[model samples]
Target: MPHSIKRIFTWIFWIFVLWAIFTSPNRAADLVLTIWEIILNGFNAIAVFFDRLLGG
Candidate 1:
């Protein structure tokens, strides 16, 4: 993607995040935690798959 487009998207994303945080701090925290757990679970699943594939 073009640098300008990337920058615009980044700014928009940050703006949304700030809006969410300011509108409802608790909801924002829960959203972040949920995202984090999803990412961690994905990583764990990948690791398990690799481990099983390698016969470990």
Candidate 2:
């Protein structure tokens, strides 16, 4: 993408994120928490697989 377009998208994304955060902080927190949990679970699963493969 062009530099100007990229900047516009970045600004728009941040604006939306900020709006969501301010409009409903609890909802935003829950969304972030859920995403974090999913990421952690994925990492945990990968670790378990590696441990099993290494016979640890």
Choose the strongest candidate by TM-score.
2
Q: What C-alpha lDDT do the candidate models reach, one value each? A: 0.99, 0.99
lDDT of 2 by residue, 1-56 (tens): 89999999999999999999999999999999999999999999999999999999
For candidate 1, the per-residue lDDT at 53 reads 100
The per-residue C-alpha lDDT of model 2 at residue 49 equals 100
For model 2, state the Cα shift of residue 2 in Å: 1.7
After superposition, the stretches of candidate 1 with alpha carbons farther than 4 Å from their true spots are: none
Per-residue lDDT of 1-56 in model 1, one digit per residue for the tens?
99999999999999999999999999999999999999999999999999999999
Mark the regions of model 2 whose C-alpha exceeds 4 Å error after superposition.
Answer: none
